[model samples]
Target: MDTSGSLSITHLIFNASPLVQIVMLFLLGLSIASWTIIFSKSNSYKAARAKADEFEDKFWSGIDLNNLYQECIKKGQDLIGLEVIYSSGFKEFVRLINSGPADQEVVMDGTYRQMKVSQSREMENLESHLATLATIGSISPYIGLFGTVWGIMHAFIALAAVKNATLSMVAPPIAEALIATAMGLFAAIPAVMFYNRFVSKVEALENRYINFMDEFATILNRRLVRVRSEMNMKNNDVPQTNTQQPSSSYSQKSYNHPLGEEQHSPYSRARANTHSSPYQTPGVEGDRYRNTSRSPLQGQ
Candidate 1:
């Protein structure tokens, strides 16, 4: 018929020394902060994951740049990973078209650069709040230890001040001090879990970004090759077909050469420039993106 249970929180607090009470308050604040970070980070990571999946599907569906850009714009520019890629490329496209007449090389280069910039910016946004989690994870244990040490010191000081202290007078305060150590561990455990989780999430996202960039670059390169090959065929075939056509028609056709078709073909130049990927360059967004990846782009 023994119905005794562990002490209630109300009993513990009422009996706890002033120093123990202070340490408990500190632990409470830290616990609240850790939970807040956990909840917020959970939402952030979830959104990032969802957006990345949605964007990849759309991007690979062979939608035109304009269409992709329009969709992202409707969803707000902040819509995670893929939106950054689309926004950067589209912004550059607009800039190139706006900054007077430019060849295909210039336009493509600008677009590539912009895409890289956006990718980096998006990565930074994805990683922004993780640092807070990291801080809690790294420092919380030490903070808890400090509280424990303070509580223990207070217990010893109380024992010294008492003229004839028995086990009864000393044990309760010592036990209360141990609570601070336990509270510290409690705060620390979740922080460590979250930190590790976020680190893994960031790594997964980085890989996806890199893979998408490589594949997208390949697609663009293929388009460039096709354009250049068509242009070269037209130029080389000129003499072969000139005799069949009236001189005026042939000359008129040559004069109205499609902008990038004849000169500075996007194919070879892009291939040569493959020594450097847009992600490798130094810029605000570029730095942010590359730091997260930590792998140098090995151009083909």
Candidate 2:
């Protein structure tokens, strides 16, 4: 049986029709290429997941944002996955804030957009070459089936040339033709299995990235809100001296009473002219000072 199997694989391939031989070679090439993709994708996914995990731990560990951003910049393009997303969002946050005070909503919107773009790029990197695997898995079996059909058709035609047909006459050619189908299944099954497996991994990674992005955005939004609030407070505390200046000038003009006689005036125009003051005290004390100054002006 081992001898028959060995001959079936080796000898049959050598004696197979040119079309069948070509089909087998094609399937073999596809199988080789599929395996290469599978192994490469496996390593890539593994590294991506590892990096994501590492970065997530660091991100949630209460590290400072600036420190993390600086570190990512130092890493340069080597940063991947969640690291890239975090860096992109934070970088946009810093840029928007540094350019000038932006509304919290606008800052968050820009940060989220940047992170989303990074997420898509990272997903593309993670999913690269998966289509080839899928194509190989989907089409390999059909190609093998086509080879089998063609080989079987040739086998039947060869039998038609025979005067008498027997199991011995029919079995070898039929078995050789069926090898095409076997080769197809051989190339397709692993590809389909691995493709499904890798797709699941990619999806899981994508979910993790999305969740992290949302959480990071929330953190960034809070920071932006806090920053905006502090800036508002500073602006409010600045004291609008320019606006008060006009009010003060108007008050001084009214108190001066340029047309009134100095003795008759309730407040002295000479004092107002001498002071030329923009600030004036208000309430009863100010009234007392005006009355006292008026008494001096009246005595004069």
Candidate 3:
């Protein structure tokens, strides 16, 4: 009700019942919250996308994995998105490899697990406040409808007391009630749209992380294989045969005897006697003249 009998949004809002005004206030709050989330997520998603693109470029630029890991560590707390996943995996890998000999499968599994945990953490960060946004989108319109219904009911009740219902009397309250549904739609539409958009973006990022993890794991495995192959080649390049004597050396030596050597051998069995006995027995002389004994000479 104004001086010219003209009703505006302000008039409808102010002249609205306590309950209706409360509903409007509540819808306004939802609208405000939704917008805030929209803006915040817009910025967050933009930054996330940019960071992901930059990381992908760096990762695929033929840079050494160790070098990339070192760079990520230097970034420290400023690391985001794919960098976090890569650094976590690489750190775990280094620790496992340096910890000593271990099952290669176990090492790779641990690395992948660490990366998965990091990916989950990133997803959590991105998905925060999304549920609240969905809730507001779903419930705001119904809440507005309830407010409109209440206002219309209150309007009809007032008209019953006045025995006359004119356009001026009828239109304002109905318009006020309709404003509630309008507010409801306003709060809900953007919330729904933006919620869907953010969810899609989040899913895309998740897939990206997963794909990267698989590719990264493959790269690490290849590196491991290459290192092992190189080590094998080095080992093969070394001489490992045992030293042995020639056949001629074996022939020159015997059991406990060295033939053709001046040294007396413990196994010498063909040594000549140095002394000969001149005395001989009678029968051993075989009838030789020297066989005559001294007793025969005395008889002569």
Task: Give the top-scoring candidate (lDDT).
Answer: 3
The residue-by-residue lDDT of candidate 1 on 254-291, one tens digit each, is 22212223334333233334443212222353334434
lDDT (C-alpha) at residue 211 in model 2: 75
* Ranking 2 against 3 by lDDT, winner: 3
Which scores better on TM-score, 1 or 3?
3
TM-score of each: 0.70, 0.76, 0.78
lDDT of 3 by residue, 1-300 (tens): 789878888898888889999999999999999999999998887888778767766666556566677789899899988999998998887777655445679878999999999999999999999999999999999999999999999999999999768899999998999899999999999999999988888887777778778877876776555444544454356465523433231232211111234233211211111121111112222233112211221111
Q: How accurate is candidate 3 locally (lDDT)?
A: 0.73
Model 1, C-alpha of 200: deviation from truth (Å) = 0.7
Off by over 4 Å in 3: 236-238, 241-300
Name the lDDT value of residue 132 in candidate 1.
74
Residues forming the 10-long window of minimal summed lDDT in candidate 3: 272-281
Residues 1-300 of candidate 2: C-alpha lDDT, one tens digit per residue = 155543446777777889998999999999999999999998888888778657755665555566667789999879988889987887776666544434668877998999999999999998899999999999999999988888889999999988989977777676777888898999999999999988888877887778777766766665444434543454456567755553322233222222222322213323333333211222343334333322211121
Which candidate wins on TM-score?
3
The lDDT-based order of candidates, best leading, equals 3, 2, 1
* TM-score for predicted model 3 compared with the true structure: 0.78
